[model samples]
Target: MKISRVTARGFMSFDRIDLELNEGVTVVTGPNAAGKSNLGRIIDVARLTVASHAGSQRGNRLDVYERAPRHGTRRFRLAVGIELDQPWEQELIATFVRAAYASSAVELPRPAHSPNVSAERRDMDARRRLAPESVAVLLRGFLVIHYDEGARPRWRASWHHSSTGDLYEAVEPVWIMNLRNGGPLMRVKQEPSAPALSLADAWRRVFPDDQIDARTPMPEQLDFMGILKRLEHPISLRTGAHQDNLPLLDSVRDLYMLLGWDMEDARRGQVDFVHVLDVVLQRACVLTDNRRLPLARTFPLEAVGGEADLEDGSQIPCELYRLKNGPLPLRQRYQRIQARFTELVGTGFDVQATPDPERPGNLLIDVTVPEGDHEYPIAFSGAGRQEALFLSTLLGGDPGRVIVLDEPGVHIEPTLQRRLIQAPDSTTQCLVITHSADLVPVTAPGDLARIVRLAPSHDGSQAHRIGHLDPKDQTRWLQTLGPRDVRALLFSAGAVLCEGSTEVSALGTWWEGSSNPPSGANISLIDVGGDKSFGRYIEFLKAFSIPWVAIADGPALRPASDLHQQMKKQGILTATEPDSAEPDFDAWKAFWAAHNVFSLANVFGNDGTAAGEFEAYLKRLNLELLSQVDKGRSKPRIGAAFASQHPMPKEIADLYALIRDRLQPARLQDAQGEQA
Candidate 1:
């Protein structure tokens, strides 16, 4: 099973959020408190809720009421859309229907055959013919949990199905199951009723004479436990009774057990909803739980020998021990983990779990550095190394799991951070909540849509999936953004996009020299290569709701310039050329400035002079400082030297102040208050 969508309302930092998830890696990124981590928390809470309902032993539970957003609705809802793989869906349908037939709750039309035919053959034939019909009864499935201020949290499992047409297009409600406070599973009524009715009465009303229609509307209220008791009967050993037996039902129960469901409960008609959800979450969702810390320095020997799946980094030492000493397949997995760690650190090392001599039944983890031929306890290694090792194990594991990592790049370096994302196999769907820009470049250009950026708003947090860009534009976007530029723009409160390196250098120098720099205010200065590329960056930043202002050279405002032509091509500009000989440069500059694109000529009131160009303006303002730089030095180098040696020109300083004020209003107000 794979998750296609996640929706949350009035939950924690989310007032309402509907996110479409891709099949492969989906990166969630934003500045602090933008609800990136809250997204992970949503999944974690769902996982825990499922676990509580499915198992007798309850784990630590998150109070849903406490998680409600302040000043928002007291009630909240979370839902996930699930899509089952064809093979698994077929197996589930075949087994479930077969079980229903065996229990005598449903009867199938008899197959035309001779009396000499074996009973097993008849049952198999019936299942083969009925599987397609049953598939249509569960066309689309989703799990939803709702919490009210004064009531117990409730879970509702609903499926959209249809009796006719293709199952894929089915939209009619087939069945709905509601479970509250671990009580009996009840069917949701199609119409309102005064009170609950017994399962026998509701079943009789819905399906008389033990006849069943898989596509029939669910009754107003029916208890699954009562139905299970009514269906229970002793199986006869005679050949006549043997013909009615459905062996596939046994396989269905086993499948549930394999997925960590309680077998006894399954036989009693209780589905382990948590284990069913795990078919999508894959037990890897725990990696995103902030409460689960990394692997401890040492663990008991018995703890390291268990067969339970690794739920978090704390179990890594145990998992490593099992992999090292287990069978061939496991040993191979261990080697892969070792290779991954080596790749991250650029050094070969061996991981081993040695028995602690002083502490009975305890094990200590140590790393062997091949170059020095010495062993060191893993606890003594740098925090980055420990985190990298933990992450490498997660990436190297079997594929097909949904691995939701929350800031896996926290201690990892940039180069290894790229490798960390790349290491997950294609089948392992990764939802990474991160602040690392290094991960952006490694993502396939076509899959840029997988990047979901969040920003704060009046309601709460909003998410924007940067959908696919044109092929040419995608290439240009990546080319213009280096690591620093990407980090600056992606994580900043506001950004300034300029036409060339000179503006960036000059503005950066001025920013650094100020008592309160733009950096201190979380404002980013980005050189978007040239004015022609500003449109693309502006669109990209807008998608993430990042505030931005652009600085363009004087020539860009001319109708015949490349930037103007590009904007026209992109359909951002559509005005016809003027009939007059002289183009209105001042009017064009003013027009663009209103849209947050400031031209040097208009901003500095030098529209008709050489100072219209930023480079020319810098030379005119501080010729002596510009001359101090080497003649062969780049324009950016000269701009930097000029800003460092002299006070910023009045026009540039005024523009900088305006940008700071716009991006950091609260800070500006505080500074003003201090002066008063």
Candidate 2:
């Protein structure tokens, strides 16, 4: 399932906001505290809540609402829209209320006494809002994986609270839900059905937890459990083995949830159920971040399942060494990771995962850069390369998972980011939160990928869907401009787009000489090629909400082109007075007085050739009997020289006036307030 929209009410720093998502990948961008990262966290929390509901519930009461913003309204609501291939859509709404259990008996009225009481006392106006079960039904059929800041995966053992207290049971409730029937549990071909045996009997025969409560939901038995239940002979259990291995067994289940059934099905057809459980139980992995794989000791490469001693003589997790039918051994998995990392990063650096000497059970990923004769650690390389390796490692292995990338570092090049996120109709769904414009692309409308911009609102922050670039315009932009150059426009406060390099230099020089300059004014003076390219640039800037205006040659000189008429139709240009007999630059000035944009073409003489370009018009405006202008002169060079030596021309001066008077103040205010 793909996320279509996220509606949040009173969710951290947000009073109410709706973020509509596209299919394959949706990039979230905004200034700091505008709540960009918070959006990702909200989704994670929503999914986690649903996952929480699939298993045991101690009571009807749940206290997850503790994290709600302290000062906002006492309630919050989150609604997510999911779309399935059947052309069906599901809306999941989760609500939370502050101190929901703190009220008197009246607040906790029984469902029979007042079935509507739950709705009446709900106070729909509350800022926080929902029960855990309200979100569970929608989370099925899709897996959501959240990568913390720096794009690091959160280890299975670490998803509980932040403390490091061997708290594997904290995840047991969620894990049990993952194995329940009709829960869209992974690693199996189909959802399990309700078991013929009771929960107590199933636990007694299969996995017996000393603490399991038989009354909770167990929609169906897992495949393994079903197999064990039907066995002709009872499998021998090591004395106290169930209690001693519960934690490790839970960890193995975590990996199975993520890796799915590819490895399991291979072993399923060949082995006895007892041997299968033994191999599955042995599956233990030491998870770490992409940047820092634990380096403890060195071990010899072995693929046939005998444990190799590390330099410190500690045993690696048996899972790493164990090989099952049709599954690659840990050594091969390591080599594959190294090769994929190299391919995605496009670097020849050698990556080896050797056992670290001092760390015993942990392995160290040694990155070596090739030098003339010797090699150096990969850390010696730049940050961008290192970040790329991390991202490549994180994204390469999984194909059908939901990946949430939190600030994967803006240093990853735009092209790579595009490739990583733009896989065509792939089952994987990627959501990225970035402050960099380089990661944002000009896409087709309703394309599989999109860019969403969040702006600050009075209640909190509001999110708006950013539309896409027309395909033809996007192609022209990419072909004519480098990714970096095009992306830079998004960061600029405002821009003055001109026909050629000459106009850029001329306007830049004039701005420098005036009370405000381009550098200090936080504006970009861009050479958009020519008159033909002006509309594309304008549309590009408008799509990103970047303030911009264009200056080009006269509209009258190019009669066949109705760019002016198009601009008027688009409401960008206003009507000017009827033509007068004589050339009066001031008379036409009234037409653009209220507009942020103006053109010198409106003021120049009707003489055809001279009004075709800015330089000709400048020369005509300063017509003198002994003028020494050269016809083949470098336009930008002459324009800059003229700007430095003489008073600003009337048209250029008036244009700057409109920019300062109409545009700069608002842009300046926004620039001053922009953060992150």
Q: Give the candidate number with the greatest TM-score.
A: 1
What lDDT is obtained when candidate 1 is compared to the true structure? Answer: 0.60
Error of 2 at 246 (Å): 17
**lDDT values for all models:** 0.60, 0.45
* Cα-lDDT of candidate 2: 0.45
- Expressed as tens digits, the lDDT of each residue in 1-676 for candidate 2 is 4555666666666777766665566777654446676676565455444433322231122244334542434555565444322211111111111111111112233434323332123222111222332223222222222212222222111111111121222221221123212222122222345333322233234433222333435322323333232433322111111223223222223223332335444223211112211222112111121123332234433422453322111222222233112255444554554565566566555544656677566545455667778887656776666565555444443343345666765556766666555532365566777756556655544431376666543456666553455777456656543445555565455678787877787778888887777676667788877666666667666655566766766643232244445455556765554354643555544443444445665444346555556766666656541144334667677667666666776667777877765555434444444222
Give candidates' CA RMSD values in order.
8.1, 15.2
lDDT for 614 (candidate 1): 82
Q: How well does each candidate superpose onto the true structure, as a TM-score?
A: 0.76, 0.55
Question: Residue 494 deviation, candidate 2, in Å?
Answer: 2.4
Model 2 TM-score relative to the real fold: 0.55
Least accurate 10 contiguous residues by lDDT in model 1 = 233-242
Error of 1 at 55 (Å): 4.3
